[model samples]
Target: MLGTAGKGVGGAVVWFTGLSGAGKSTLAEALLPRLKAAGKKVELLDGDIVRTHLSKGLGYSREDRDLNVARIAFVSHLLARNGVFVLVAAISPFREARDRARATIGDFVEVHVAPPLDECIKRDVKGLYERALAGQIPQFTGVNDPYEEPLAAEVTLDTSALTVAQATSRILIKLRELGYLEESELARAEAPGNAASAP
Candidate 1:
């Protein structure tokens, strides 16, 4: 049920975790179309989008963050069991909450999108890193608050070392190895015409 060749009875959840500006959401967005092209029913649950809608009242406290992660995991579990591949791009900083999500969603793949802290700061388009460093924003994940790196992620992509396409291709290969995708679909995705094939 979990890993059939095509249009399986059950679907998997690919969870992306990282600090702000670390490219978790970007990577998830990049992979969305490829999954759809493979004929899988896929849904993307982005952290900012989820916070604004699903967990609107939640604050940035540790308890609140864990609750938000739980809510995402709950929805992802429901979708995955119903044969929808769920891509969750959340800066779920706490390893404990992430592990809990992994347990809740049995067919889960944890992807740690970690670039260096300095690199993440450099990529901050919203200038959140600057504000946080200036003590304007409290409880920021990488600055004021702690971000517990994944102890054993199924896939780890450092945006500084790998291009977006290369990182995405690696994720595709992992998904194929895990049986959520077929060999033919993988071939098509990595073909010369596909962006994921770019060097």
Candidate 2:
């Protein structure tokens, strides 16, 4: 947590890994403005959006998956080194890929957002689980392919069990615990009537 810091001295990657509909993107979107409001230079990189721009035409094969992850890691690394806090919300199913990312982007916090598969099926917001279960989609993580759970993620949240506010609060707590966030910033964030106010 202390070696290669973000941009000037506070850059870090809050890497969120999980199933497609497990709240990674939603959480990243929610976390960014909070960090920024606390005076942190943060950026959110959603997986699907990255696929369209940073990793166009990448297939679903293992090699392609690795490539996509590496590409995301590369961008996050650059930003982190330059003092930008990168909040990445990617399914990044492979542990090795996550390891590569951790190595590339120092001062990283890995948060695993995993709801039970059955719950995911029930909440299949995009019909992804149903399609994958019915053999309509190939190489779907958690349905057809694999999701290597993080053995030691800095934070793990089950969306089914925790509200968005609760989950985000947990992450903030960890950032403070890791010395990534200052107590004053956290107090400002938690204080009454200042949730959406700018820094």
Candidate 3:
């Protein structure tokens, strides 16, 4: 369990890593609101948002992707250290980079969002898989670039079988098991005058 000085509240960095259409972003977005409603300070750092901000000029090369992941990891670490939960949904394909991120962020929890490739292609919200298939996008992870999965991730969710709510529940259960939230917290949240009372 992690500890914070004075407040006794610790922050966790939940990294949702997988292929492009693996539902990482969707799960992260869904989980963020639930976490916030539970009185937890949470931030969602989606890959597309980070790519637009920190990695504006970077291309799809392996080196650039590594750098982009590193940058996001650094920011996530900083926020987590300040007692804010950080949710990173990114296709961090390299094992080394993800390992380095775990080392940098002490309370990092790697959640592998592994959906079947065919299922991902079938639910191509951004048409990335189609573009990759058409040779428009080169060296795509899960196509050309390798996605070295974590050997010992804290949580693994197969979105092909799990709905968004189910996946979010799994993550929340893990967070509770890790002592990130007390069992009584949610009950207190429902009580009147509590900070997390529903609107």
Name the candidate that leads on lDDT. Answer: 1
Model 1, residue 190: distance off in Å is 2.2
Local accuracy of candidate 1 as per-residue lDDT tens digits, 102-178:
88888889999999999999988899999999999999999999999999999999889998899999999999998
* TM-score to true structure, per model: 0.93, 0.92, 0.88
| Poorly placed runs, candidate 2 (over 4 Å) | 1-3, 6-8, 193-199
lDDT of 3 by residue, 51-142 (tens): 99988999878789889988998888778888888999999999998988887777888999998899989988789889988888899899
Per-residue error for 132 in candidate 1, Å, reads 0.5
Candidate 1, overall lDDT? 0.88
For model 2, residues 1-199, the per-residue Cα lDDT tens digits are 2247643375889999998878888888878877877787888888999999999999999999999999988888778877788999999999998998888777889999988878768877789888898999999999899999999999999998887777887888898888888898777555555343221
**TM-score leaderboard ranking:** 1, 2, 3
* Model 1: CA > 4 A from native: 1-8, 196-199
How much is the lDDT of residue 172 in candidate 1?
Answer: 91
Where is the poorest 10-residue window by lDDT in model 1? 1-10
For model 2, what is the alpha-carbon lDDT of residue 87?
92
Superposed Cα deviation of residue 135, candidate 1 (Å): 0.7
User: lDDT, candidate 3, residue 71?
Assistant: 92
User: What C-alpha lDDT does candidate 2 achieve relative to the native structure?
Assistant: 0.84
Error of 3 at 178 (Å): 1.2
